[model samples]
Target chain A: MKLLSTCSLRKVRGRNLLIVPDPCSGNPDRILEVTDSFAWLVGHFKEDVFTVKTLAIALSERYGLDDDTAAKEAANVIQIWQDYHLIEP
Target chain B: MAGLSPDRALTLLFPLLRLSLWGTPLPDAVKQETRLLNESDWEVLISVAKNQSVTGLLFQAVDSLPEDIEIPDKTLVQLAVMADRIEASYRRISTASEIVLTELRNEGLNPVVMKGLSCASWYPRPELRQSGDIDIYLPKLPTKSGRHFQTSPDGSLHFQQDGVDIDIHSRYFDIHHHTEYLPSVPSPEAEWMMISLHILKHATTSGVGLRQICDAALLWKILPDNSKASLPIIFKATHTMRWHLLLFSFLEDYFHIQNPLRHISSKPLLSIIAHGGNFGHHSTSRSRLLKAPSFIRKADTAFRFLLRIPFSLRFAPREILPTIKELTTGNLQHAFTADSHSILH
Candidate 1:
C-alpha cells in the first residue's frame, strides 16, 4: 500500500501533523498529530510501495528490534492509518 | 478590543503585522512592543486581526513571541484555535486546487493557479495564509467538465468538489482594459500585473485589507530584478502607474518594504482599511448604516459608495469614468465589459 497522494505530512510548530483530506462533503481537513515512528513509516510509504511485512522488516532492521515486536507495531499502525484513509492499496 | 478606536488600534496593530511577515526576523523593536503590550492592547490587536482576516498571521507572530512576553492565556487559546482552523482550511483548499488543476490538465488545458495558492509559496508557513477558495485562470471555459461548474454573474465559473470552493476565471481581471499586455503564458511580469490589478480592483470598490497588501508586498520582495524592471513599462502600458506608485508607498509605510521605484506617500488607503476592515465588511459606518431603518440603510449604502468615488478616482483616475458610467446605468455587467484595446489619452 502507498500513502494517499492527496494527504501530506507537515511539521508545524514542532508538531508532526498528517493532513488527511476528508472523504465526506465537509471542508476542513483532518490534521492528526502523529508520533515520530508513525511519521517515519508514512515517509517510507510515500517513497516506496510496501506491504506491512516489508515495512516491519525494515523497521526491525533500523531499530534493532525483534521481528515479532516490529511486526505487531507496524501492523497496528498500518491498520489505524488504513481506517483513517491515510493509506491506500 | 471591539470598541477601540481604529486609528489607535492600528498603532499597535501595524507592529504585529510586520512581526507576522514570513521569513522576516522578529525585530527588536517589535519584540519590545509585543513585550510591553498589556492584555487590553493585545485584545484590540486580536479584534483588528480578525476583522482584517489575518488572525493566522497574528497567531504565528504571537507563537513566535519570546517566552517572557506574557500573552494572556485566553488570548493564546483564541489564537491557537484560529490557527488550527486556518491550517484545516489551507489543506482543504490545496487539495481542491490539485484536483481541479489535474482535471483541467487531463482535459488538455493549461490552468494557472491564481492569487491565494500562488501567493502561499512565498510564506514561511504556506498554510498560515488563510484561503477561502481556490482560484484558477483558464484561457477559455472548459469544454468537457464545464457542466459541473456554475457561472457567476461576473463571468467566472464556480465549482464545489469535495465540499471545497473553487473559482475559475476566464480572464485574470474582472475589470476591462490593460489585459492585452499580459502574456498568454504565465510569467513573473504577468503575475505581478495580475496581483497589482486585483489589488487595485478591490481597493477601488470595497477597500482591501492588510492581507491583500501583504500578498503584494511579499510578491514584490522576491520578484527578480528583471521582472521588477518590467513593472514601470507594464504600469505605464496598463495606465496603472499612479496606483502602482501609491501601492509601493503603501507597502513601505506599513510593511516597511523599500520601494525599488521612486516613493510616493500613501494617502487615504490606510484610513479606508482602518475604517472599512476586510472588504469593508467591518466598517463602523457601514454597520451603523446597516442598523438604520430599511429605507435609510439603502440610502446610506448608496451614499457610502458615492462618497468612496473621489478616493477611488485619486488612486485610479482611468477607472473613474467607467465606474461612474456603470453606477449611473445601474447595470453592474457594464463595468466588466472589456474595452477592446482602448488606451486612455
Candidate 2:
C-alpha cells in the first residue's frame, strides 16, 4: 500500500487533543484523527512503525529536538495515544 | 548556483550520480568522471567505495557530508564507498523488477509495475533516477479478512527478494469518495485501462512532484488503450465488480477526501467508479478494539491517531476558517511538502 502521510499530537481542548498530519507526509489525506494524540491513519500503518531510536532520529531533524529528547517524547506520546485508542496498537 | 548551498547541491547531485551509475551502463568516461571528484563529490565517492552497496553508499555519503565543510578527506572517502554500494543496489533493483514482473505474470496476474521499476524501464535514461522499492499495482479484491492478500499474521509481507520490498494495494487510498456515483459501469478488461486508472489515481491523489507518478502518467498516455470488452470475461479474469465498489467507497470515507477523478479525464474514472468497484474502509486499528500483538501495532495506532486529526480538519476546513485560509491561500507552492531526504532508501 502507498503511505499517504504521518502526523503528530497537538493539545487542543483541556484534555482533548488534535492530531495533525506532518506536512512532510507524502500523502496527507489518507487518515483521520480521533483526538490530538490519536488517529485512524491506515490499516497497515502498524507495519511501518519505526523503533523509538529510529523515530527519534527522524523527528530530531524536523522538530529541532535532540535524539534522546525526541525519542523520549515520541515514545511517551505514542504510548499515550495507544492507551487512548487513537492508534492501532 | 548563487542560492544553492554546498550541502543542497550535494544532496541533489548525489542522487543523480547514483541513479546514473545504477540504471545506465556507464562508459569508462562516466566512471572516470565519477572517480575524479571534487572535495564534496570525493566524499560521496569514497563513501560508496567503502560501503558494499551503491544505494547504501549514496545514503552514507549524503549523511556524512559536513553541515559545514571543515573535514573534507574523511567525508570524501566515506562518499566513495557509498557510491559503489548505490551503483550495485541500482543494478539489483533493475534485475529484481524484471524477475518480479516475470513471477507475477507466471502466476497469471498482470502486474502494472509502478514507481521506480516502471520509471527505470520507461524513462529515456533510467540511470538518472533512483528508486527505493518496486511498487506493483494489481487489481484484486481484498479477502474477507480486509487486508492485502499477502499480509502475514505479523502484518508484514515478506517477498523472497533481497534489498527489495513490495507494497500491494487493492485500492489506492483507504478513503475514496466517488464509488457510489459510478456503480453501473463495467470492469475494465484491458491491461492498458487498468494501468491508466492506476496511474491516474496516483497522480490525482498525490499531486505532481513525484517523479514516479509523472513517469506512470507519461507511460500510460503512450500505451494502447484497447483490449477485450466483455463484463463476464473481465469478471472471470479478476474478482467481482462489487469488491471494487466497496474498496473505492471505503477509501472515500476513510481518507475524508474527494475522488481523484476530478483531476483526470472523467470518462475512465467514471467508468471505473460506475462499475461495482468501491473504496476500502477507514482503517481503524483492530488493536484499538482488541489486544495488540506488538509494539509496532501500538506505534501504528499512535501514528494514525495523530494523522486523523489533521485529516479530519482538512476535510472540514471551514471549521478552522483562519488556519484553513492561511494554508490554502498562503505562499506555499505545493499542497503537500515533505522532507524527501528522510524517506530515501
Give the alpha carbon lDDT tens digit for every residue of A1-89 in model 2: 22222333221112221332334542222222344222322232434755556556655765689867988876875675555444532
Query: Which tens-of-lDDT digit does each residue in A13-84 have in candidate 1?
Result: 444667666556433367677888778778767867778899889799878889999899789878898788
Instruction: Place model 2 in a CAPRI quality band.
Output: incorrect
Off by over 4 Å in 2: A1-89, B1-80, B122-124, B141-158, B172-175, B180-293, B297-301, B304-308, B315-345
Each candidate's DockQ: 0.09, 0.01
Q: What DockQ would you assign to candidate 2? A: 0.01
Q: Which segments of candidate 1 are over 4 A away from where they belong?
A: A1-89, B1-5, B22-30, B280-305, B324-345
Encode model 2's per-residue lDDT on B1-345: one tens digit a residue: 134333333334433333333232334554444444456555443332222112332433334333432334444333333333334456777787787677667667766654456555554435433455666666662222212223423122324355465555444322233333322222323332344344333222221122322243334334434422242344323332333333233233322223322232233332332221221111222223223443454444344334334433433222234333433343132223321112112
Query: Model-by-model lDDT, in order?
Result: 0.72, 0.38
Which candidate leads the pack in DockQ? 1
Q: Which of the numbered candidates is closest to the native, going by highest TM-score?
A: 1
